[model samples]
Target: MSQILKGGCYCGGTTYTIAIPDKLPQVVGTPHKVPTSILDHCGKCRKTSGSLFQAWIVVPKPWITITYKYKEGSGGKLVEFQSSAHGTRSFCGACGTNLFYDSSKKKAMVEDMDGVVYLVNVTIGSLDEESLTHVELVKPKLHVWWDHGIGWIKEAFTTAGQGFGGLAKYPTGDVRQSPEELI
Candidate 1:
């Protein structure tokens, strides 16, 4: 059975629904192969979210529907930013809530043999807290851009016994200093 998940922006300006596949793929060791969710620590994600890491839910683009409203009287609308030549990032223009990341080029390149469009990534933090009871189903399977990750992030995950074995390390050196060490 497919599951319907609801989410919106911080100011309730943008709302979305996502249909999750019943038979989600298992968390695999390969970063590109994992089919559920992933945590990103790349410079762009960190700068966009102002967080050390951002959790994203990966699903087929066709599974999502989004609507935007400016205020009580204003009609629905959406604002999108072309983050890269082939990638677009959407957000609530009114309140600046980072909402989505779409890579049509990536999807096109990965279309199935049957020519079906593939997946897109949405910020997991945008979902309504109450509607996230089944969040475990979308728990991040791996951490990407580990070389750009903050030291405390690594330490926290390590302390929890969920070390960085499944991490995707970029060539950039680890630049983050742990707060504890600084204190």
Candidate 2:
């Protein structure tokens, strides 16, 4: 069955819905494939979110709908920042909350996806807190950029501080999908 996951900025200035297909596409570039989501610890993600790690839900561009509203005499719209040569970031101008990470400039991990489309990743934290109760549903299969991660923070997570679950860790990127699956 399909689902439309709801999320928005902290100030309620921006809102969006993710149309979850019956089968989530391999929208995230892999060696980590079919996660439909991931926990990002890359430097870019850290700087943008001002957090140690950022959780993201990945889906095709066609699957997401974004709306902007004006509030408090402010634009109250999503401001786009070209954070990287291959990626663009969007956040609420009113409250400065990072919401969307656009990877259209980057190439899909699997070359043979059948058609041209880009992945639009959303900040999982922005999703309704109630929807996050089901851990497995939003759990990331891989932790990317581990080498750049802080040690104590990593240990706190890996050594069973509390509510810990083991996920594959990759220092640089992630485990790629099988060669056959690429086509």
Candidate 3:
């Protein structure tokens, strides 16, 4: 069965509920650690977010849902950046919240085969782990772009079993359906 997962921004100005599909498509990329502060590791992220790295999950676009009313704030709507010609990142205007990072550029970018759509990654600091314990379904699988990560984060979660769990040996070759089944 499918599940409804709810999350929102820091000020509660925006709220979202995503209908997670029961099956996740198999992912095609091999998990690798990279030395970078942000996946979209560039000057834009550092200046906008005032942080070294932005926490993100690389997922397909179809899986994301942003509340219509909350799409923008008093500052203005999120200015999407074509980080690369193929990827996009959305950031909040008012508070500089790093909202979403998606690789889907357009319908033309979508692939024919079934695969995991998007990353359901949330801001580690933005979320209250105790409150969302049950809903905190997925942990960081492979810490990509480790170069930009805060020094403390790596040192804290690096312990083998402390901050990791779920599947043994992780999934391989693009998910065939929605990750809802695993949840």
Candidate 4:
């Protein structure tokens, strides 16, 4: 079951669609990890997003397309910032919305298929409301760079000897009681 996730920047200046295709055969030699979304807790991500962690919908460069426009009707690509020697972060200049992180440089390549270099780590929060509900559909299977995040973040998300003390979970917007309350 593949999905097309739609997203845009705060001011609607930037829009994109991520087409997640169903799994295919691994024809490339050597080990390769399937392209799945991820929760990145690295310091750079946190600093760039001003969030504790950043949820990324990882997609091959070919599977996504982006469009952006300015206030005066100047449509252009995202403003790319080279945050690291091998990586870059792109955002909408109009509204300052962080969009994607690219790490296609061969020097920093860790997991990629043969001839496949670029992967867009799309900011999940930028996705539309309907796409947000399809969180499970994106298949964000890994939590990476957690060691660089705050200590509590890891504890709350993982078993970590203690049970989940993370963000409280409520089924809906209101803080309504569950199970017995409804019954």
Model 4 Cα lDDT, one tens digit per residue, 9-73: 88888899887656632324424343556889999999999998898876667768787555676
Model 2 ranges off by over 4 Å: 26-35, 105-114, 160-183
State the local distance difference test value for candidate 2: 0.74
lDDT of 1: 0.73
Q: Which residue runs does candidate 1 get wrong by more than 4 Å?
A: 25-35, 72-76, 108-114, 160-183
Clash number by candidate, in order: 0, 2, 26, 0
For candidate 4, what is the TM-score?
0.74
Tens digits of per-residue lDDT for model 3 on 23-104?
5434445333211112433455545556665554333445546663444336644556667767566665555566665554
| lDDT at 120, model 1 | 82
Measured against the true structure, the TM-scores of the candidates, in listed sequence, are: 0.72, 0.75, 0.52, 0.74
All predictions: root-mean-square deviation over Cα? Answer: 8.6, 12.5, 13.1, 4.7
Using lDDT as the measure, name the better of candidate 2 and candidate 3: 2
Cα deviation of 115 in candidate 1 (Å)?
1.7
